[model samples]
Target: MFRRDAGLMAAYLVDAETGELLDDLTDHRREFDLELAHTNIAGDLMDLDASVGLPGQLDPIDLADSLLVRYENLWAELTRSDVFDPEDQYLIEKRIGRLNELGFDVEEMEITTVDNGKQVKMVPRVVEHWHHKRRLASLTGLQVQENQARRLLNSLNRYRIILSEQEGRDVPLPVAAYRWISEVFNPSVQIIPHDLKGGLDDAELFHEILEHRWYLSEERHQDVGMPYAAQSYVDNVLRQRHH
Candidate 1:
């Protein structure tokens, strides 16, 4: 069980049975050997190498403390909010932009007017880093990066339009997503030759095809269908990667 200690700001590997830090793994050597010891906070375990021959040269407790301090400082900045001058309304936008730059998306925020509207207090209601990733996984069961999920959602929307037009009725989002995944995303990816995959995963291939479609549309001054763009990308770009 991994639990965060706010005061320590570091996740400790605890001995579940003793309810204490698993400081010495030597006792558990028979169960779990430490061949490649990995610790969080930018792999600070490399600092231990200098103490190979010395018993107390590298203190794990001190290392954990340092990591905790760094974590606390970073967590504070990302979540901190403050009162701003009412006249500078753009301050909120600037803060939101900074949050986005730090890989967080503000879903909602609470704003309060104080000092008779002379100041504004704004706090994020929901702060999340995996906004698009969560949405894509929930709707389509496809785990992907935020940008890739957003682009794929746009493609799914276009597919919905085609479905609605063909059926002459309103098509639900889930139904459209299912059809898009089955008829378009799945087949398009599965058809890619194994050797020419070029280390590209399914989500990456989907994203690249979407980009290829945009370029083809730009050149022709109209939309090039997904099928055409995908085939061209696989045959020309992916196949020629080794060359």
Candidate 2:
């Protein structure tokens, strides 16, 4: 059943992924549908598996509901208090930092002076995740998670510095990205065996290589290059999965 909302028929209870009717909205009554598809919800909700790393078998609708509750609770905590001191210069930065750490960007917000200008009230009108991933995609066209993008970006910046030093001039980001993609990223990714591709994507594999490089550098008291690090990871670490 559907209900008229603003002169439109809308579903009250439906399968989110399959869009199958579960209940009619006309009487606000629940209807059970047994033939709906079992796939996960489409679009951003499907990313929950990779983002939250939810283990074991779980229904998509249950996962989506849990995430919704989590976000709702976080929003309540962030905006419930309207008694922030306006005199603290670092308060805004602190809030923004906290939001970023929680994997959200304040897309739109409103700040108002309250209590005769003694206090401040802030409300985040819009929030977005994938902040680093969006920027990285725009620059390098490589889609990855926020943490993975950050690691890849650090490596790209290092590659940029290397290029500048080698060429005796400042290197632009696009040029550096092109070289880094060809030399560092592509080569490192290709070293992974085909059978092991199921474990991690290219960006994640590269991120692991960066971590391995740091560990090797610490052990040797010198920087271990990417090529050596990739080889060692594949030979010693990844090869065990096949056996």
Candidate 3:
């Protein structure tokens, strides 16, 4: 009825036993499907899945263990043994760097005089860089982890710079990004044979290609282009890995 009324953009049929969507319905999902999948309710699913104790599923205890480790690590890094002087110039940068190293980005920081106005206390408002994941998805139609998005964006920025240098003018980011997607990224991905994809998604595959390119360039002491690097990656890395 919804399809007849043109109200349905897509539909899915899932196998209840396996929790897998029907293969035939894979193409029916809209562009925003992945974005929707990563919403707040995804956390609830993760928690439920963890508790279910299903084989090959994420373990709740393990998840808690990892979170505890990360919490302790952050606490250790942010905690100071002695009071810092209010005028310390490098403290902010140092704190920001530590947070960034832990896969966080500081959006705002509040530093106020404390300890009888002799020392300062610093509090940072941070994000886990989830915006990078969203930005990459919106721009490129690719959903990837935050670190992978950061890596891809770094590569895109480098591509933009080279393009600007060649054209002798600053190219806007969105424009350069489209060009990079068409010319560099898509082409490199196309070179990977379907059978040899090794179950990796597009973003992960592209990241591996970039890593392979860097490794080959360093080894050969020259800039090996994307095509060459991609072919080499397929032959050496992808072929060698078991699916």
For each candidate, the alpha-carbon lDDT, in order, equals 0.61, 0.62, 0.62
lDDT of 3 by residue, 178-223 (tens): 9989998899999889898868888899989877887776676556
How well does candidate 3 score on lDDT at residue 180? 88
The estimated TM-scores of all candidates read: 0.47, 0.47, 0.48
Off by over 4 Å in 2: 1-129
Model 1 CA lDDT for position 81: 66
lDDT of 1 by residue, 1-243 (tens): 333332222233346654335655453551232222324422454445444532656565566557556655656656676565443333444455455454444543444445643232223333233456787788799988766775576566556645664676758878988999998899778777888877878998988877777677667755667778889888877878756
Candidate 1 regions exceeding 4 Å error are 1-128
- On TM-score, who's better, 1 or 3? 3
Task: Score residue 89 of candidate 3 by CA lDDT.
Answer: 26
lDDT tens string, model 2, 59-132?
56676566556755786666654444433322333445455455444433334446643233334433233456
Give the TM-score (vs. native) of candidate 1. 0.47
Clashing pairs in 3: none
Measured on C-alpha atoms, candidate 1 has an lDDT of 0.61
